[model samples]
Target: MNSGMDPHSEISRNLRAVYQEVESEEIPAHFLDLLEQLDAAERSQSKKDTE
Candidate 1:
């Protein structure tokens, strides 16, 4: 189970980190898409788990 902190906030923080790296041109385009997909999947799974 997830802990005390807000899941959306955690997701936002992780997305922010990815954005910072992408802004620096550190991550590739395909990798960025992959991460986005993964984030989407995680959110979907979390929703299912909550239900």
Candidate 2:
């Protein structure tokens, strides 16, 4: 724990590593479905705007 590095930089580096680990995991099926629904809604809105 005492590598002579500043504590703030060490903490930030650790937090970023943890976040990258989480970001690499697969997203849940439910969340993917919700994202698809949002995309569909945006397309629908675009079509309405064009009309």
Candidate 3:
């Protein structure tokens, strides 16, 4: 544990590095449009639910 080489900590560091790399990438425009479409659909569904 003093060496900071515990398996759990190693796995966590590797996962954090992977997450940071993925987080830095740019999202495609089509994906953004799809997300917006999803948001609109959810809003429509919620409105229907309230009624």
Top candidate (lDDT): 2
The best candidate in terms of TM-score:
2
Tell me which of candidates 2 and 3 scores higher on TM-score. 2
Model 1 residue 36 lDDT score: 96
Q: Which tens-of-lDDT digit does each residue in 1-51 have in candidate 1?
A: 866667479787897788888787766789999999999999999999999
Q: How high is each candidate's TM-score?
A: 0.47, 0.52, 0.50
Residue pairs with colliding backbones in model 1 are none
Which scores better on lDDT, 1 or 3? 3
Q: Which ten residues in a row have the lowest lDDT in candidate 2?
A: 1-10
lDDT of 3 at 27: 91
Task: Report the C-alpha displacement of residue 14, candidate 1, in angstroms.
Answer: 33
Candidates in order have lDDT scores of 0.86, 0.90, 0.90
Pairs that clash in candidate 2: none
Give a tens-digit lDDT track for model 2, residues 1-51. 786766479787898789999998899899999999999999999999999
Worst 10 residues of 3 by lDDT: 1-10
**Models ranked on TM-score:** 2, 3, 1
Superposition-based RMSD of candidate 1 using all C-alpha atoms, in angstroms: 15.0
What TM-score number comes out for model 3?
0.50
Candidate 3 stretches with Cα past 4 Å from truth are 1-25
